[model samples]
Every structure is written in structure tokens, then in C-alpha cells.
Target: TKMLRHGEVHGKPLTSKQKGLFGLLAGGGKPTRLKKKRDRRLESR
Candidate 1:
């Protein structure tokens, strides 16, 4: 369900890297700096 929802929102399937990041997040790791920066850019847009 998570993968399906992610695909629906992004309009494409997740790549291995993206899936790995999602796994990291699900496992309670802090968001990486790059991910935080990207999220900031998206929010600014």
C-alpha cells in the first residue's frame, strides 16, 4: 500500500535509492541532509 500510494503521488515507480531512503525512514533514522534540503526546496516552490 505504501508503494502504491508513493507511485500515485509521484506518477512513477520508486527507484532502489528511493526505496532505501524510505526504509531508512521507516526504521527511525534521521532524515539525511540531502533529503532535508530537497524537502526545503520543494516547500519553497
Candidate 2:
């Protein structure tokens, strides 16, 4: 029977390009940018 392994289907692995497309299709696409944390001391500057 075919199985999934490490983000792969059957015995074939997903390529970098396909991974991105699949991620979006699976609704797990990465955010465009991460939110940066601001230090409390920096807020006063």
C-alpha cells in the first residue's frame, strides 16, 4: 500500500517547488513575514 513519509507520497518525495504548492493547497502556507519582537528598553528610545 502507498504511504506518506516526511511530506512525501508513495515512494516519491516532493520537490522544493511542489512542496510550496502543496503547502498552500493544504492551507499551511508560511506567512509572508514573521512578526518581530520589540524589547521593552527599545520602546523607550
Candidate 3:
């Protein structure tokens, strides 16, 4: 994974929680409720 590779390069491996936060900050966390709302809207169409 890019995050793991990044950690390796930086010499600081991130924990699962930290990876989750990184994903959130990068706007790649589709687990957010906003993603669900967008999915619902698409389905309604």
C-alpha cells in the first residue's frame, strides 16, 4: 500500500488508527456518512 511504502520511506510506521486518520485527511475514506448519502442520491436517480 502507498501508506505502508510511505511509512517505510519515512522510517515511521503508522498504526491502523493512524492510517485511518491519514486516509480521512487525504479524502479517500469512503466510510464516511457523506459517502453513504452520495450513494443514496445516486441510487435514487
Candidate 4:
């Protein structure tokens, strides 16, 4: 929902946050980077 709305507005990708959050919840795997989240946020802007 967030990514869809963001993609509609910004015409850019908006998925890393969702992916990172999902990865956190899922647990036990490779870690996600904060830089990725920051980059995605900047792109959303």
C-alpha cells in the first residue's frame, strides 16, 4: 500500500522499508542495511 502510493506519486521504487521490516520480523537471516532504508526514503522524496 505504501509502496503503491509512493510509486504513484514519485514514479520510483519504494520497497526496501517493507522488505527490511519483513526481514526483521521473519528473523534468522542476513541483515538489512540502514543505508538501504535511507536511500529508499530519499528516492521516495
lDDT to native, each model: 0.73, 0.55, 0.71, 0.60
Ranking by lDDT: 1, 3, 4, 2
**lDDT score for candidate 4 against the true structure:** 0.60
Candidate 1 lDDT, tens digit per residue, 1-45? 487346534577787777777777877787778788999999998
Go through the candidates in order and give the C-alpha RMSD of each one to the true structure.
5.9, 10.4, 7.5, 10.2
TM-score per candidate, chains pooled: 0.46, 0.41, 0.40, 0.30
lDDT tens digits by residue: candidate 3, 1-45: 587448643677688777776677677555676678999999998
Error of 2 at 16 (Å): 0.6
* Tens-place lDDT digits, model 2, residues 1-45: 122237677767878766766565467655343223345446779
Error of 2 at 5 (Å): 6.9
What's the distance in Å from true for residue 2, model 1? 1.4
lDDT of 4 by residue, 1-45 (tens): 454434433565647776566556456554457668888999998
Better of 1 and 3 by lDDT: 1
lDDT of 4 at 4: 41
Which pairs, if any, clash in model 1? none
Candidate 1 local Cα displacement, residue 33, angstroms = 3.5
Displacement of the residue 29 alpha carbon in candidate 4, Å: 11
- The clash count of every prediction, one per candidate, is 0, 0, 0, 0
Name the candidate that leads on TM-score.
Answer: 1
